[model samples]
Target: MKPGLFVAGFILLFGHCTSSLVPKKLTDADGLVIRTGTSAGMCVGYCVFDYVLNGTNLTLTQRPNSVQSNLTTKTCQSTISQSDLNDLLGTVDLATFFKQPAVLGCPDCADGGAEYVELQLGEQKHRVTFQYGQTIPGSEALVDKLRTHRVALNECK
Candidate 1:
């Protein structure tokens, strides 16, 4: 067998194995609430964000130092379509997401920034925290979408 053909054959054979290894998609999203937010330690003026998601309603609350007289907490409300919510839920692999540790990396280390994504189902809950701008392995699509939504909400006039 030619060397190139041998390599290609090997790849094709193993690549097929990964098909079954794909994470399972979440099946039930009725009681699911996904919360995500970001915070910075050494920053001023609205350095903290708290996002809460319930059904199609999304609420974002931003705050700076309470002691600082110039900045105050701001709350914003937004609604996402059910279709959009379904799309976001479909990107999550609940099995893999729940398996992740409570803290993935050094979140907020060195005063850079920190972010967290949490899932609540019924009475069970799981949360993963990582450095800001870092992407989780299995839930990349969901996280990216949420981050974009947060940005849009913050930028809203």
Candidate 2:
């Protein structure tokens, strides 16, 4: 075998072994949290937004895209009850995340911008990178809940 091949194989094997040493704490979390980032464009900078749903509280942050004249960033927040959070979770159990596709594939993205979704509960956390409106199955329910309460949230567009 070539000398370069031996070095490459050793590096790959070593990297994998080292990665296994890192513990996955998110998989053991007791509470549930969902974070999402949405953006459009083949590249970067185009109406970027982020959201975090923890316990009964919701927060939204947005930043203008490159095309936009305003460069300001905005943040908004709202709340939901623990029972309501339960209802949302009932629609989509946490385990479903384990079976989630690595990429949700945004069908609506004209040319495919970018979107990221992360779900955390206890020590289990799942993250997906997809396109706009193209998230995993069962996510719509949670999205709907957020939308229904969007009016109460600040800085979330």
- On lDDT, the candidate that comes out on top is 1
Highest TM-score against the true fold, candidate = 1
Task: State the weakest 10-residue window (summed lDDT) of model 1.
Answer: 19-28
Tens digit per residue, CA lDDT, model 1, 1-157? 6999999998998878554343355433455788999988888778889898888889998888555669768888998888778787888777778889888779888787999999887666789999999978898998998987787777323
Pairs with backbone N, CA or C atoms under 3 Å apart (clashes), candidate 1:
none
Each prediction's RMSD to truth: 9.9, 8.9
lDDT of 2 by residue, 31-110 (tens): 66777676765444336767788877788888777676646778878778877777766655455565778776553357
List the global CA lDDT of all models.
0.81, 0.65
